[model samples]
Target chain A: MKIEAMPAEKAARAGGRPGSEALQRRLAVAFAGALVVVTTLSLTVFETARRALASSRLVAHAHEVLQVMNGVEGTLVTAQSAVRGFVITGDEVYLRDRDSALLSLESGVQRLRDLTADNDSQRRRWQALRDRLDERVALLDRLVVIRQTEGAGRAREFLRSVYPPPPPAKTGRIRAITGEMAREEELQLAGRMREEELASAFAVASGVVLAVLFALMFTLGYLAIRRRVAQTFGLNAALLSRTEEAEAANRELEGFSYSVSHDLRSPLRAIDGFSRMLTEDYGERLDDEGRRRLAVVREGSQRMGRLIDDLLEFSRLGKKPLACSAIDMTALAGEVYRELRTADPEGSPAFDLAPLPKGWGDAAMLRQVLANLLSNALKYVRKDRAPRIEVRGWAEDGRNVYCVKDDGIGFDMAHYDKLFGVFQRLHSAEFPGTGVGLAIVQRIVTRHGGKVWAESKPDEGSSFYFSLPQAAMSGFTDPPAARGGRR
Target chain B: MNRSRNVLLVEDNPYDVELTLRAFEQNNIMNELVVVRDGKEALDYLFGAGAYAGRDLGDAPEVVLLDLKLPKIDGLEVLRRMRADERTRRQPVVVLTSSSEEKDVVSSYNLGANSFVRKPVDFTQFTEAAKQLGLYWLVLNEPPPGG
Candidate 1:
């Protein structure tokens, strides 16, 4: 049986799924961006609050200034009313009221000056208003003095003369200054109130935006985790079902092989046994052709028996549980060669065995593979000259590759497809084989998670190579046979 | 060699029975050999029941060469029945079959079979196995105390 060469599959590099990793990275970046936005918004909210505080203070200051201006206007009007009452009724209580009103007016103007001190324009207007208030209070006091000293008629005349309002110029100037100052404070108060409102709205908006961002981040993370879990479950379920199917198929195959081994061999035995009995007990009665036919029958039965045994061995190779061990390849090859040599003690093959590396595999299975390969090497040589065989091993690409090269009647590479098939014989007439040996070799190598292939040229030689994974070499003690040295 | 030794051969295949008888003749093992064709007949003969009811129970076979595959009942079931009965529990049974499967060998031993041998396809090998078996069981080894 010829085994066709199969290209080895390169091992896949170890890494997480590229798509999922990119998705995870993107999720991280998005989350980080969300946090940055939240942080920035939080700063915005805090700044708004600070601005609101400052604006609220400005509003309070504006209200205080307006209140102080109104106080000054109220004080001046009360002083004027008290002096008028004193001059008209000649009442002493009215005169005392005028004196107290003048004192209150003085203090009100002084307070207004202090409150408007931070504004240069307001301070100038306040100073002018203060001077006007002082002049108005002095004029009111003079009226009260006139009502007391010159008597009622003269006081009335004096008031009338001054009451023309000094052509409305000086008092107008005082009223205008106070009105302008009050207007300025009112404008500032309105501006500060608007700023407070805007700040409060910004604070609320930022809070809401930040809350939404947090919710979004949480939802995205939850979805990512949920999707990954669901994918894993789906994959696990598929793998579980596939494994069960494979196990069922394996069981069926084992049953078939068992029955084949038991039922088929019995008939073959009977045929061979009876044929031998016929020849032994009744050979004299048969003619030459008859005896030759009987011999043919025995030989046919024996060959069929051999075929059945080889078939059983091939099937059993698939089912046998491997007992793995560390193997010294050089010692193992020597052992197989010695055994093969013993089997054909009359024939000597020139063996060129190179230094072999240690390997990891089932010792018995490996022995079977080597024995078959070496036997093939010894079998297919020309009868005219001695057989030359080479054995070598090397480690490459995480595997140990061993090669058995023989100078024999090599097969055409075109027929390589028929190799390693059970019952496939390349040179059945020339080579005596059940055609299952290379098939058994293929089965054993595959079970070890390895591959087998060959390179050959007709009449030159054939080189058969098999490789075993390096990972299987560890965690095993060397076989006892290997330690016992060459037998 | 004991001339009075008796052997029971249980097999369903006629050709196999002939081949075995021929091998025994070739080996010159001349002890009296009784053949039963099936598991049921073998059970009946061993226990002296049915067609064997009139036979003396004390004249038990020294060894039973049991074949695994048979008609009516299988070898394992027959072995189970034999081991279960007090009358036949101590009788020596050697399983001789074509199957060399690990499960068959293990099951035969588990059912109290004394030995398991695969019937080699070669007649010469068969003759040798038969000779060894007869020399050991009927001639050399002592039977259990008569029931």
Candidate 2:
């Protein structure tokens, strides 16, 4: 029983047990244990009560037998005296006394027989006593009859002829039999009383043991509940402090970013502006090498400026809460495509845009994702041929999956792991990029609870995929339903 | 161009001050430009007190190009004080600063700034921004009745 509850206790500790379930199990175990103890106590008390009842019956039986034996003895003595009186005085009143004594003795002997019937030894002794009483009564009757018929002289002569005088041993024989039955009943009563004492002691001991066990279980259960409550209190306090610490750290980080926004850019602006001035103002006096050095410095400063802007934008995503709603994928893609077309007017990429499914996300962030992915497809292309890009979307596995496939200068699959990393570039010089674009894209997609991946080969086309949860497409915020349009 | 109309350039950076002057010169706006190094000097010039105690307040600048980060009093506080006084309240103050944080922009507009523009790191963009500032505030847009 104890081993069975161990797993439940472990589950409670592991936080796998729900609050009510753990409490219910604990209460049930406690109740079951208490029930077992109470039932055992009840059974023990019941057995003690039965034993006490039997002991009481034995006591009553012994008392009744003793009383009946005394009555029989008294009646026998009285009858013997009556018979003797009648023989000596030849009186009719003495005969009446013997008759009344004989009647009482007969009833007493019958009661003794009934009482001693259950005990073999007692019944045998009773039978022997009954036989002796019958013999004595017969002698008494014969003497009385003799006295009434022949007169006092003849009755006395008959008695002397049967025995020279009354034999004392013979007359005391009935008294001895009654005395023996009474002594046996007294012995049985003493034995029954001792057993009653022992049984009473055992019942008291069981009551004490049950009380102690109840106290122990109650104390243990109380301590267990208190300990669980205290542990929960400690855990809550720790969680509160940890949340406060995290908030403080977030505030400090915001301050740092503010400084980065203000202080870091000022110097870079000065460097680029001063270097530009140097190039325009003193280019005539400086040699080719100096102009080139100045050009390199300007390029480095501009590149650093772009890197700082991208880094700040990336960090801003983390600080801002997402504004999620149903997104019109087709409209968003169309807008981004127009902007991309305006951005790169020289490279004419053949764009094939298929119907896109309605998705759920922040519209602005999703636009950024489309912008980055599409522009990436546009940017990484073989200079020899025109860029062929296809944008399509579908719903699968409870997600809206969008794919951007492009016939571009694809990358080696070995370095695919670093594709979404910040500041990681496959082709640094040939492709002019800060490499933070894909990282930002991944961050925005991930914030919307989506995943991004790519399939690319060295010379073949590359396809990039991102999926958003379809559950986010709510009926209330869906633009298509609101507009009542097929698009 | 209105050579007599004054344009105040309140900036702490010497390089930026020089760049702004070059941008204005290239744009061929020969307006009388008054350059102050910090907020205090700019306030003094506008209120005609402390250093410019004898100057006339009637010759207020046509436009004030204010930088936010400064040595003494910052630009937003200057704008707040300017808006408080009737003499400088309606003056065209455009916030030109290195910081483009949303808080700064919102606060600048709230404090009665006419416009807010972040200083571009690329000098060419800065030059174009300066040219537009000169043409729009000094030449195209109509000023308040008193200023």
Candidate 3:
């Protein structure tokens, strides 16, 4: 059986989409929520501190008012005792004590006025207390003078006036005033105690609420971070699995390629060898028609050899690592053009070589790309007109832009999408290509992280452009002369 | 000078062996070509072991034509054993295989093979190659003296 070589398939596998956008959205929501929680917690803390400070101030004011009331009551009792002692003993010592008590009473009344500054009701009560104390003091002074001069009888009269065994109306009025003052003091103390209670309660509640809120915020923040880490781990695992699968597929393909090249070639060689032997041993006995048919078989086997060679070259490109370095665009283009000219020296084609920016790239691969483009341009030129080819380059937006323009049998814009695909051809077999040149160029460009495209119109002209990253330029230097010299 | 030289041909395929024998006849090598279908037979012929135990070890072939792929024992193992033995270390072993793989070529040279040649598919080319090789090894090239 005649063994026929099948061409290698060249379809690219599609890639999976990433979930970066969803992760970004979740991160943003988490950040905003954290900000709100922090703000609310801070405000609660501030209010709690303010209330604590206000309650302390109220406590201090209530204590001061209580001290003044105690001093006033003590002074009234001391003065009444001194006056009664003088009246009973008829002694100057008691009279002196009565005068000193009068001095203490006046000062106590002044202090009561100062301590009750915040309350109008307490102030009015203090004024009434002061008036009553002054009346008592005046009666005591008269009794003291009488005791010094008129003896017990006049002293007794003065004492009666000062002590006032009591007019019911006046006593009731004084008692009412004292009651009002006591009530006012009690009210002030009660108000201060209420504020303290409220402040304590508010502080405790705010502390509890803030603690819970902060804890919740912290927990949520931690959870968000953990989730993000988990998602990252998942993404990494998925990427790792994809990489492993691709590596496995690549290894399988390599094995298959080697087996095809080695095992398949052996049988093909036998077929070719045996067939040749038949023609050699029995040629004279055969007719011209038979010889022609045998020639067809030989030609078919040779075509199969060419197909195998092309397939091997295609797979080799995938496994081969690129050697990247700085490449002088102008020099590289000139070298390719020179080779094209030598291959078809008699064919008239005006060439325009422009000054080109240097770029980082693989020298051999770049040379291949340029050779393919120039040869294609030369092959497709209009039959009537002389071929014209132009090569130019420049830096734009931190990238190197290279273009090859030609006056040729340009293709329709509708078929532009098919140009870079493997085995996709617009021209007939007569043009003499395996329809793999452009596809190879695209693969090399993509490996370099660059983009390539073409613009053309039928029967007019075509221009191919490609862009490469500027950063790649620093490592690669152009070969002073093309390595494989002009063809 | 006219003494017929002994040649050992190690190959698996009968067709390839037939073609090689025809090539040798057409080229007038005038040598007693010894055929070994696999590496085991080749080893037996060289070492005088197994079925060839009664043969003289000193009467080794002038040249051993080795094929890389064989059924019982591979050609590389046979070549390795030949190079290791003092009695047959200097024996001329030529690699004649269908594969032009770089690894095979490199390995044959590394293992002390006297020469390496890929068998051409075309009958005419194969015959021409055999003629040149026969002249070079059997007629022109000198063999090492028996130990």
DockQ for each model: 0.60, 0.51, 0.22
Winning candidate number (TM-score): 1
For the record, the alpha-carbon RMSD of candidate 2 to the native fold, in angstroms, is 12.0
Per-candidate local distance difference test: 0.83, 0.84, 0.75
In candidate 2, position A281 carries an lDDT of: 91
Residue A215 C-alpha lDDT in model 3: 72
> Residue-wise lDDT of candidate 2 within A1-487, one digit each (tens)?
0123444544556474347567768867776776777888888889988988888888888888888888888887889788889888878899899999999999999999999998888889999998988988888888888898888998888777776757455657777887888888888889888978988898889888986787676776677677677877766666666567767877787777778877888788788888988999999999999999999998888888888888888878777777766667877787788888897787778999998998777777888899999998888999899999999999999899999999998899899999999999987677888999999999989888899999999778799999998777755554652121112
Query: Which has the better DockQ: candidate 1, or candidate 2?
Result: 1
Who is ahead in TM-score, 1 or 3? 1
Off by more than 4 A, model 3? A1-60, A79-108, A135-157, A164-179, A188-247, A261-309, A316-327, A336-351, A357-364, A375-389, A393-435, A446-487, B1-147
Tens-place lDDT per residue, model 1, A1-487, is: 1112211211122134446777788679768867887788778877887887788788778787778777777777777778778888988898678778778878888888788888999988877776777677777768777778889898788867876664245456677888898898988788778867877887788778877887787678778767777766765665556566667877887788778877888888888898888888898999999999988988787778888889988877877888877788898898899888987876677898998878777888998999999999999997878899999999999999999999998899999988889999999666888899999999999989999999999899899999999887766655554642343
lDDT of 3 by residue, A76-106 (tens): 6677678668777876687677667767767
* TM-scores for candidates 1 onward, in order: 0.66, 0.65, 0.54
| Best first by DockQ, ranked | 1, 2, 3
Interface RMSD of each: 0.9, 1.1, 2.5
Fraction of native contacts (fnat) of each candidate: 0.79, 0.69, 0.21
